[model samples]
Target chain A: MAFSAFASAPAAAEPAVRRRSWVALVLLLPGILYLLLFFITPLVSLVFTSFQQPVIGGDIGQYSAGFKWENYTESVTQYLPLILRAFGYAVLATVLALVISYPLAYFIGVKVRSFPLVQSLLLTLVIAPFFISFLLRTLAWKQIMSDEGPIVVALKALSVFPNDGHITGTPFAVVFGLTYNFIPFMTLPLYATLERLDVRYIEAGNDLYASPFTTFRKITVPLSLPGIVSGTLLTFIPAAGDYINASGDFLGSAQTSMVGNAIESNFLVTQNYPVAAALSIVLMAVILVIVGLYVRRAGTEDLV
Target chain B: MAAGTFAEKGADLELVGITKTFPGFTAIQSLDLFIPAGSFFALLGPSGCGKTTTLRLVAGLEEPTAGRIVIGGQDVTATKSFQRPVNTVFQSYALFPHMTVLENVAFGLRRRSIASPLEKAHEALRLVELDHLAARRPGQLSGGQQQRVALARAVVNRPALLLLDEPLGALDLKLRRQMQLELKDIQSEVGLTFLHVTHDQEEAMTMADTIAVMNKGEIEQMGAPEELYELPRTAFVANFLGQSNLFTGEVSGSTPDALTVAIAGQRLIIPTARAPRRKGTVTVGVRPEKLLLLTSAPAPSSGSNALGPGRVIDVSFSGVSTQYTVAIPGAGDVVVFAQNMVFGPVVHVGAEVWVSWNVEHGFGLEDSVEEAAAGVQDAAAAQSADADTRTGVTSSVRA
Candidate 1:
């Protein structure tokens, strides 16, 4: 039956198209098996765990496999503030990353293109942070904003910061860390699209009575939509669940704890396996929903 | 936005002492030109002749190093491109890939705060016979379709002047021919000043009301197509515009009606009216089609010049005409294009023949033999790989 269904397609297509072939199936088999083993299998177990219940009078970290629909509601009620804060921080970081990366990408990809050496050097600077570990970078930022740090001490002397005020444990620090870590993700994709942009389209926009700013709004932004969409996805999805920047050991403190930190503490220290799994599932679902709405609203399928 | 006095109707364009110098070389020398409103003018030349630069200066995309640009009796030298009454159909047909055909065409009207942009866009699309494809994206259209869409997008604004920068260079030969004629029809219908830049000689001849032959950042000659082709005053114009059988020599004698020049002791007559004004040495030539070849010496014909007894070195038979390369005793090879009329005997290679043409068909140039020889070399180099090289340079300029 499958063969019959597939037979009509290849027969109609010209040979040049090569629409169906066993070589393709063979090529895809490794990827499919790899995803099933490494990614999908763990995901299935996580879903099952999200629906499990704790054992009555049992040891810590032990659970009974059963339907527990109340687990979702219980986790949402207990850590509601953390979940909301996680999403809010992610949105702020994504917007900041977009604004900062666009100009940098434009400068490197289009403006300095005539000087190849300068372009390469600027691109290297953007990617240089990746050589260091993510946790190390967050820790470094924490030290730079500490009370005794050079920047904070200078700000205090200038009366820019309060004498007794602290920079760590603030929402601003966590968001700043998120934006900094994800900026390369935004810049590289934006550069990929902007580098290949045909200048004539922009010139045509100017020729059609669009001012320079208007041309940027109508022509350059629309042409770079693909990059913007991918960059935002890269930033928002990971940032929403990030624990390092919000953990007490890094840029943030207990007041700034996100959904990730809550899940980590429950899973390891508190040994509340069901609540941790439920919280994890909630975060995933929330990200998926927001991303779906965003992609649909952007309408980049036609723009690119 | 100092476009307060902008004229919606077609407007004349004038360039006074315009010059543009790039990093290594001057693209346009100090020059002055005036183009009347509502006329279809063409700038024709080989690659890198600065025609595109001149078009950019007039479009206000490039500022002249030293000159004033006037349009419709207004000095617009400092006006920005967006405020100028000009639009360009780029060589690559640079349509916005994100927008649909109708949206792309309506873009300008919307920018200018004009009402009912969609209706006007549809009307322009119908003018180009592309209304049926209005909803399709530019990326989905074929080259010819995209070309028409680009044209429609520019014409929808009804700018006083429209610049076409080798707009059909990307199409196939047959499609380019079709678009040439279609563009001519659109030009007449719109009654706007259409400044077309092209490297294709046949296209300029087929579409342009007037053609300017440009060489090395300067206008060599400008006139009606037939006039320029028949009586080119410069060696560069004669060779660049079309194939010429140039013979360079010192003037042997002169009469009230004609001047005779000696090449390898063989004399050829050029009408005094067609001779270049400055007198010492002269280069005279005829178009290939104007030359006739006879297997034997003709009985002395009136009002004609004859060069004799040459051996046919090569014969290439095209459908409508056959080209023969004849090697004269003292002169270099001269090319003659003979019509392939039915019942005419075929002339094979190695045949002895006499090459001849009417005296009125001969035109003289003051440029010497060295200049004509240099022109022949430049023309040979330009004919091959000219199209891709030019388009590549244009696309890379922004970088």
Candidate 2:
């Protein structure tokens, strides 16, 4: 009863404080309205459109008249395999990028801290490829993999593969391109996190009679987990939604079409707004679930 | 040439002329030291005086440019840190953030080619009185608790030597005092030789059985803490170890057991039974606490000496004691400290006082005077050369 009375006392005094807080609310009204109008309204409209069909006059008011469940069901049934394939490619690309970039990042961050010029040069190299347009970069890869290109001729000379004229229209090529495009994203975050790590931990490990490999495994790896989690998420999410290289000259095959390609086709060619909205919702949901589990396992503070 | 044999029992570690040099500068130069078996030795110095470097050399984190390191009578100069039987508690504690207290303490044991890891780790934690924090991560523990965990981790290995690099520097004053006594007690209980590095004079005096005072890559003096304080051999040692009043003088005459030095137109005889030789020019050193203040002159005594007749320039009333800066005829100023005997009249600022000490309380530094004068000349020449080289490098870097 005393606790209840104490709580009530605070509640009775809150109205005057709340009236003052209204002044702050008034000051924040513009930003709040801007977010509600531009960000939340679009998301709500998209959600509504994902379940509603267009009327005869092609007006959005038809969404209030009726709802269509077939949009969602049809997307799951017809495009499930494509969505799964996109996720698979994203996972493969993220893993490959991590494997290739972690050691490089460690070397640059820790081993080269005394040489600022070398570190800056390496960072510039990582970011240099991003300066070119995405379409141009993918097109350049296509040209390099063509029959008359040096890669094909060299492979033929080495007898690595049958003079299989061009390897362009393949899922392997699409994944390779995606991995190459997203490697910088993985490496930069890993470098940032690894750079902030205290090198004294390694020395302490050595003092504890741990060999170099044991120290790296026990101290370096576990301490860099936050970086690894963040780098993987940063790379995988964007790679999964990427369709520029898959639909461009790099790999113009049905087998290589990701959910992004499917959404683009629905919006631009077929004009099926409902199905496109459904596909977008599904992709967002899948990404949310995967990222949610990853953050939970690693802890939210690490993810941020 | 005077290499000593290792003790048959207990932890034995020795460094023979260990030297560490950076690109163009030497951090430690030809330092020969030995930690007697089961002794708590302190490497004490001011900041950047190479005490920490000496500890690192012993711990195998750093390789000496020219020397040998032997631990437990085994030559460990060429061995890696992990292969040596020495462990270090770094200044920052360096506890693994990812591991719990139990896991951190168990790290070394788990890596060892041993059978029962958990039992050993548990026993070690219990020894440090940290068994209750077994499951807590290092980040969750307080600074003192983290220090305990670090100690537990190092001791669990049962290494021949424990090297501590200012392990308690991060703690607050009260906690540090508590840890200092605890560390000494733990060393005695464990019966392990500890090579601890610190710049705090009080910490070294409180914890060490033997303290080596270092300066500019060299050991200035090494002895028991009280011996070094009472009879510092050089002006550097006297100033670095504690606050001392120094007076430069020329030796006027000498006997077998005493030397009369003339300072500021006053003749003061120093009882120097331990003097290396009959002196020429000397620096007389006396601790502030040793000087006595007399309002009236005493009868002539054989062992009595006086260094001043000037007025008191300033007086500071510290809680437990009072300090007076007395001015002399030729000497600039001399400080004297007296413990508060009773709550009587406080010494006024401008009171005339006689500063005196017994001959036994004064130490003569005639040999150090010659060495210091030569060192100053050489240092001046070296400074010019260094200035030229630095300017050249700056120009090149700019280009």
Candidate 3:
């Protein structure tokens, strides 16, 4: 009986696999439809709208579809500084978050591994910030760093800033908010990678006569490259396109506007659909290029 | 003492009163050991018996609770692992995955500030026959190849002592056997004190010049392989190293060269040298190969021959030897191994036969608690017995 079952198992495997593939296709239908409806359609419309020509003396912001590619050039000419500042702030925040999170992740992952309670407690603390609304958290920072806040008052009294100067509505405040809010994004990926690192490799390094620092530089850092790349990607991508942290009504002033704020104002306040779509397309393209080059230089495969 | 030149002479290692205790359990009790210069020493035991712990202590990876470790006549008990003149081939092979083979082998030399490390690293790789794969990373090599790389990486430094912690355990059985011979060849060519730790009894018996069998964190017996297998001191050693058929009986008489004991109305003579020191009631043991199964009882040629009647209960043929299980009247089931040197009549189950062996083959140990107390005092006295007398019995049994 067992021999017949074993001999017939291979004959039955083909139909089972064919049915499983069909089941997989059925399982993937909803996700594929959702992407097609929400992502691909809007992406196509955005590209189409980017090449539209504005009506001459039409209503406030009416435009018609045509080969008027000047909309792309005009959006770039008007919002180039904002675009550059957005990417600059994102780069700075990603770097700052990585610098702050790598050691914290290493401590939580490796140092406290023997203490299960303390390790989980620290990991929960790293993720605890996500319990609150991100916009509300940015608003809270706004109130804390306002001119009437204790920090600004103390800085004024210490002559760190002039009496009339204020920290609100500044690039520094915008960068600080981005760095503070995205730190968890950078930390989780790093922690996940470092948690699986084998301590025996480090011991082997020490046994081979490498000093502690030399071991970290030669062994730990290289082995943790995948974590560093993924962490920076998670922090940098969302930060480049975030509008609430850099809006004129929030941390930013008119002078500190970024591409996200420009796109928001153009679409809602000014109602310039073509220019807004053009600016959004430009931001996405520039980020894709930068991330591709970064990942290539880091020598990792596709995104995490 | 010149740089980059390995000394032909090996270093002597000594451990004095070493003890290692964890938070609640002691891994090793107070222990003392000595490995002479250039000798291949092995620590063999089952799992969790502190063989690895003892090797780690010698490598300076674990600090002993109370002891001094001396190497090459220098007190290195306080030295850190990196500063100690030793290297270990880790059980996991722990090769740097990111570095090329040459770089991994040259890592130790670079730390020592040796000049032209690549040249020396290539030389080491050639010794392991891995020089052609020098540019490849560790992940690209096979398991056996990676093992050789680990060996090369450690041996390049020419540390005073080379510690192998189950080095060949990860390979397939055939490869393990081949590597054992190669490892023996490497140790002889390098002339360094190699301290190997393994749980495989055959591996220890084949490679080590001196074998220490540990049990529950202490050495049960330490001697040459033949001496340990032929003449074990305790029941634990006798059972652990090989199979032993034991019979507990009272001593009826003693002479200059034989001991007469009565068991279930039958008299047996045991060699005096192999007899227990305190001979009231003792456990007599003989290896399975020493007991012979015959169709009938033989004539008593001398007082040093033992013969007993039994019925064969089981018979098994294992290529070169035939095994028979015999049930004597009071000896329980006794196992015997008969050599298949010629086309002999095969014994079947339930057949009556006689079991026999020379008197010199039986060894006795004190079985009762009262005699065992006196046995402790006679431990040193037993050691005083001449080694030549032991060789005489072991060599005759080998023939």
Q: lDDT per residue, candidate 2, B1-399, as tens digits?
A: 011111223578888988899898899999888889899999987667798888888888889999999887789899998887788888899999888889898888777754576777789888778898898889989998999899989887766788899999878789999889988888888788898998778899999999998878998789999999988876667766777787777889888778888888878888767454356667777889988887666556787878656788888888788888888778668888888896733567677777888878888653467665443343344445545866987786566
Per-residue lDDT of candidate 1, residues B104-128 (tens digit): 9999988987778999999999988
The C-alpha local distance difference test score for the whole of candidate 1 amounts to 0.88
Q: Candidate 3 chain A: minimum summed lDDT over ten consecutive residues — where?
A: A1-10
- Name the runs in model 3 displaced over 4 angstroms: A1-24, A114-118, A147-172, A252-256, A301-304, B1-9, B75-77, B250-281, B298-307, B364-399
Interface RMSD of 2: 12.2
DockQ of 2: 0.32
Q: After superposition, which runs of candidate 2 have C-alpha atoms over 4 Å from their true positions?
A: A1-39, A42-74, A115-118, A300-304, B1-10, B113-122, B345-351, B370-399
**Candidate 1 lDDT tens digits, A146-175:** 989988899999998889988888999999
- Chain B only, TM-score of each candidate: 0.93, 0.89, 0.86
Q: Is the docking of candidate 3 incorrect, acceptable, medium or high quality?
A: acceptable
| Top-scoring candidate (TM-score) | 1
Evaluation by DockQ, superior candidate among 1 and 2: 1
| Candidate with the greatest DockQ versus the true structure | 1
Tens-digit lDDT string for candidate 3 (A201-289): 78778777777788888888878889999999999999998888888677878878889999998999999999999999999999999
User: Which lDDT tens digits does candidate 2 get at residues A38-101?
Assistant: 9899998888879877677765433343478888999988999889988999999999999999
Rank all candidate structures by their TM-score, best first, as comma-separated numbers: 1, 2, 3
> For residues B304-337, could you state the per-residue lDDT of candidate 3 as single tens digits?
4454678888888888888899898887788899
How far residue B392's Cα lies from its native spot in candidate 2, in Å, is 38
Best by lDDT: 1
